[model samples]
Target: MPKPTPETLARMKDVVGPKGFVDDAAEMAPYLVERRELYVGRAAAVLKPATTAEVSAILRIAHETGTAIVPQGGNTGLVGGQIPSGTGEEVVLSLSRMNRVRALDAGNNTLALDAGVTLAAAQTAAEEAGRLFPLSLASEGTCQIGGNLSTNAGGTAVLRYGNARDLVLGLEVVTASGEVWDGMRGLRKDNTGYDLKQLFLGSEGTLGIITGAVLKLFPRPQSLATAFAAVPDVASAVKLLRVADAVSGGMVTAFELVPRIGLEFVVSHVEGASDPLPDVSPWYVLIEMSAGSATAGLDETLEAVLAEGLEQALLSDAVLARSEAQRADFWRLRETLSEVQRLEGGSIKHDVSVPVSAMGAFIARATAEVTRAMPGVRVVAFGHIGDGNVHFNLSQPAGADKAAFLARWGEMNALVHGIVREMGGSISAEHGVGQLKRDEIAATKARVEIETMRALKRALDPKGILNPGKVV
Candidate 1:
């Protein structure tokens, strides 16, 4: 793509005005770097369009000028999907300026919001309406809805509420040619010939730019219960999740696996952390149950599940949070696990998923393979076990060379992904296939499946201008 010509720049500046267009290198720095600092991109300019019409105008100008466009949200993505390329030729289109809650219909349990709305803000809006937007995530405070929907983010509540894709009812997207597909359907039962919204939900902006969304909401829980349990092993934790599901009548909202190493990191790196169990165990699983009514007896239901698990030896010991403060404290440990790992030095992480039945085996096989290849590698196994998604993280061994340990990312990915494929699992369970795993998709996905994705890309974005280099 040609550099933004003076004439083109002039036209673009007029469209969004001085407040929206950012060309100074210093001012555009944040949009160029990802959260982990793993990838730093170069952009000729960053455009902060404030409205859907402004986005269309900018895209139209870019389409006419043959300039590549990289759509960014709060810049919280880990896979380098929102960052521009190193070419310093693309125009970074930021949706932060478009933040707005367009409409909220409590009666319909649907919310129409701008893409720039932060996940936390959207949740607050739903809560204000006496509803629950159950897409909870660690980065909910900073991650924008556009990027969340674009990546189909799977968070803590996937066991019950489902992923970002499941919460979305409709999306208003700007096509490659700058035309808006106003697919803002609020109806739950739409007999549509084609569910085009699904294509863009997890597309990572390769197909189009998600400008607005109509999201599904649920009734707020009147009573909630949380438990932190010590399990002997991953297999036992898996069994415990099933028991909780059965006893709670499938009301288990969140079932997270917490390995011993994860808690160790939290205790060492995080402040005001407390171990939930009296004695340390090899594995831990955080269980949460929620009910729509106060009379549902969530605590009694959790007690039954724990009793059965204890009888079956599914867990060694468990503690249910007696107060809201205790519940928040228990969750703080799980939510901060990812951040605390960074203090332990370099770490390689994989967000993969398998069948609920095979998750335990998958983790065990991958852990064994990884440790055998590299002795002293501290394997941190954890994630949303209820949905079969496990965040298999490998923290650097004690006193090891950080650089040398991090250099094995590719080899580690191959080893772990191989086991995942054997178990009929996805290489990317929650995080989308951004630049990090783009090429790996070719090897992991079937020939026809790969071709079908490429076909859709061509059909929607024949110019290959939207997020050009990321995610096939």
Candidate 2:
């Protein structure tokens, strides 16, 4: 494809009004830098289209000119997916202004929202209608629904609600040729020829730009019980997770694992954060249970499970939040973990997943390997253990040179991702194969899988104009 020229820029400005476009270096600074500060790049312009028609027009112009366009959401992606590439020839197509909740069907428990709607906003809309949109995330307040769908995000709720892909019923997308495919149906069962929505859910804007979507909703939970328990180690956490899953019988909403080091960092760096348990253990698991009926004994169920875990020696200590405020406080500690790590120093983070049965082994092996690779490195491992996804991150040693430590990102990623691949795992679990992991995916994924993805990309976007340089 040819580079974006002055003429193309002028045409783009005309397509998207003056207020919808920006080329100033200062104005584009925030969009250039990624959430993790790991990747940075320049863009020709950042175009904010307020409507899907405007998006279509801008994409049409770019398609005709053979200009690469990067689809950007709230710019809160962890893997630098929303940031432009280093070519400096791409234009960022921001969807922030396209935020809108188009329709809601309470009886059907479905919602149709524009791509720019924030995850938090969607959740609020669901709650107002007495339904639940169970795709919760740490960045729910800032991340757009489009980015979440693009990444196929999985949060603590994934243990019960499944990933973002499962929550989406239909999608309206703009293909590389600027043609909109309206597949927005709220049907629960449609034995069609093929499930095309699945192709775009986690495509990371590679084949097309998702403009709107119809998402599934569930009955709102009337009672919720949250507890924080200290465990002996990763193995014990895994055992407790199984116990909870079995005892709750699908009532278990979330099961998050947090290392002692992670809690220490949160307590020290995040304000008003304190340890959940009176005594600290090597690791902690935040367990949550929810039920739709008001009379459901969620608290009693969780209490009974905790009692059994304690009796069986699977849990070392436990603390159940007594009130809603206390429950929020407990969650605040887990949510602030990434931020606290950022305050500590430069860190190498990995979002990888393996089978639930192999999670304990993966954690042990990865920790040992990372320590051997870089002596004195502090590993801060934590994530949703129930779903087999762990953020096995590493913090630089105290007083170590930040630049030197960060320079080893590739080495660290190789050591960690190699173990994930060997154990039948994914290098980019929920973050999607954005630019950060595009090359790594190409290197690690099976030839057949990669070829299949490339074939789909060609079939949907033969000209390679839709979010170029992303995914396959």
Candidate 3:
């Protein structure tokens, strides 16, 4: 619990070379801060280990010295799961140097990759082997696999592929006591025991540091069809989703809902972005369908679905992309929403989920409550409606003081998350319970749930030296 001593620092430097251990404030500044700029912290040193054995050795030293270790990946996490917590007593264990693709078994449909590999790189490696790694995220180009697994990220493809937890087959983790637990099996059905890998999948590095993993792969889709349809509201979007699911028979990969305000923000702020449809409506649903076979009727199927939706009054207007370039352009508008909002002004963001049946009610009720709480606030609501997850974000009114608006984050979060809980939803859907949501977890979760999580943490990490003060 005490601050690390000079002797401890010297020992850490010895475990990893001088170049591997960084203590200079200038050198450690980036690792000290988080992506959201919400959680700022200090670290005694940032240790970069090149291999799993090196990570184990560094962890052993930290464990023996009773020094807290915060495992960091690409530092692209929205929550403060990667940065130190300003205690200035902990050391950041950086996995950037551990980046490597160990194996790609096409026959087994799995890729054994180091935890430090970027999500995009892993996807590319899978593609080279004529397979698909379907865990797609907006931050795929920068976020590491370890952070993705720690957070159990859900991106656009989750409707068909599931979340990051589903894509993982096995994990190689270093526990708090510096013992490596190797469970990297590529088996599809191994009901041999307790399935311990699930414990660390979304633990946010609290129980242990995941060094590498065996990830599942799927057959690459040979054709993709994208469309943008304007719905009367969230309810209509939900109805259309049900129809699409039934029509496509599980080929509906993504179903995103965007508000008019969200699209306006993207068009106005993001360069080279334009409206996907000829006329805009109050709400829009971006749908994507893919098939592994070389099928030419995907476009025809999408068009038929849209025509039926129009006839049923489930959609107000729709546009189906005729070419691949046009399809990419349509998706670019949806992908650039978050960045455009950031460029516009200070925004309060929430990544929450509810039951599919309650999603429409949650969105409508939360929008009304939040607008009432802060008049003139621009509600930029959009996200994976098919999975009941919404990025219900709110931007301050133009010309409003940024500091003052951001100061009300807690109030806004309470208003939105309260509705989510009432609808039997989660406060943090894909993002894990990092430092940002620790207190929120205490407030929102049942006593038994919190107590059970704490018990698991205590059982796996008795000394509590691994990523201390995170999650439970």
Candidate 4:
């Protein structure tokens, strides 16, 4: 696709208004740089469309001009998928203006809302209706629903709620050719020959843009419980997870694994952050349980599991949060692990997953291999153990050059992802294959799988004008 000319930019600006377009380089700074600082993009204009009609018109102009377009939401994505091109050939489509909750059906437990609405706002809407929107992420406050659905975000609650794809019942999408596909039905079961919504759910804006969605909700939990426990090792952690599942009868909501190094980073970097566990073990697990009724005995159930784990010598020590503030404090330590790692220096982060049973093995083997590759490298490994997704990050050794350490990103990714592939795991567990992992995933996936993805891309986006260099 050719670069968007001045005339094309003017006409595209008319789709919204003068206030809706951001052409100044200084003004588009936030939209240009990704959160991780991994990429810096350039765009002709940041188009903010208030309505789906305006989005359709913008796409129509881009389609006619043969200009590329990148859909951006919240700008909180870590993989640089939301940013536009670095050559200023494409326009950044911002959905922030279309932030509105369209409808909330309590009977169906579905909330149909615009894609621009923030995840936090959607959660608030669900809570107002006496329902629970279980899709919770660290970026929930800033990240919009469009990006979440586009990337199929999986958060701490995936053990019970599932990913963004599972929470979605239907979607309203704007296709590559400027046509609006209204697949928005709040039905539990649809007998349609093809499940079209799945195509755009995790497409990362390559196939189309998600304009709106019918999100599934559940009954709000009345009794909530949280605990921070330390296990002997990865194997023991996996066993304890099974014990929790068995004892809680699946009431366990979030089960996360935190290495000792991660806890130290949080305690040292984040103020007001204290170690939830009295003494640090080799590994830590943060577990939460919630029930729909007050008489569910979630606390008692978690206590029973912890007792059994202690008796079996699987757990070293465990502490249950006594108050809501304490519970939030415990979560604060887990959530801030990603941020505190930056203060430690250059880090190589991987969002990989393996089979639940093989998680311990993968972690153990990958850590050893990576350490051998980069001697003195500090590994800060932690993530949702319940779902087998771990954010295994490698920090620079003390006094090492940050730039030199970061230059080994590609080599480290190859080494770690090779292990992931061997163990039947994904290189990208939750974060989608944006420009960051686009070529990487191609190398890891099978020939038939890559060909199928390419075929689908050709069929849906023939011109390759949407998200030009990302995903397939």
TM-score quality measure for candidate 3: 0.98
TM-score of candidate 2 to 2 decimals: 0.98
Q: Give, for candidate 2, the lowest lDDT window spanning 10 residues.
A: 463-472
**Residues 199-268, candidate 3, lDDT per residue (tens digit)?**
9999999988999999999999998888999998898899999989888877899999989998998888
Q: How big is the positional error of residue 200 in model 1, measured in Å on the Cα after superposition?
A: 0.7
Clashes of each: 0, 0, 0, 0
Question: Model 4 — which ten-residue stretch has the worst lDDT?
Answer: 274-283
Structural similarity to truth (TM-score) of each candidate: 0.99, 0.98, 0.98, 0.99
Candidate 2 lDDT tens digits, 1-472: 6778998898888877899989999999888889888779889999998888888888788878888888989888887778888878888999998899999999999999999999999999999999999999899999999989988999889999999999998999988878888999999999978998999998889888999999999999999999999999888889898888889887899999999999999999888889987886999999999998989988899998899899989998898989999999899989989788978899998999999889889999999999999998999999989889899999998999999999999999999999999999988778776777889988877899999999999998888877777777
Cα lDDT for residue 409, model 1? Answer: 93
Runs in model 3 deviating more than 4 A are none
> Model 4: per-residue lDDT, tens digit, 1-472?
7888999999988898988999998998989998879999888889999999999998888888888999999988878888886788889999999899999999999999999999999999999999999999988999999999999999999999999999999999998888999988999898969999998988999999999999999999999999999998988999999998898888989999999999999999999999876675989999999999999888888899999999999998999988999999999999999888999989898999999899889988999999999899998878998898999899999999999999999999999999999999998999988999999878767899999999999998888888988986
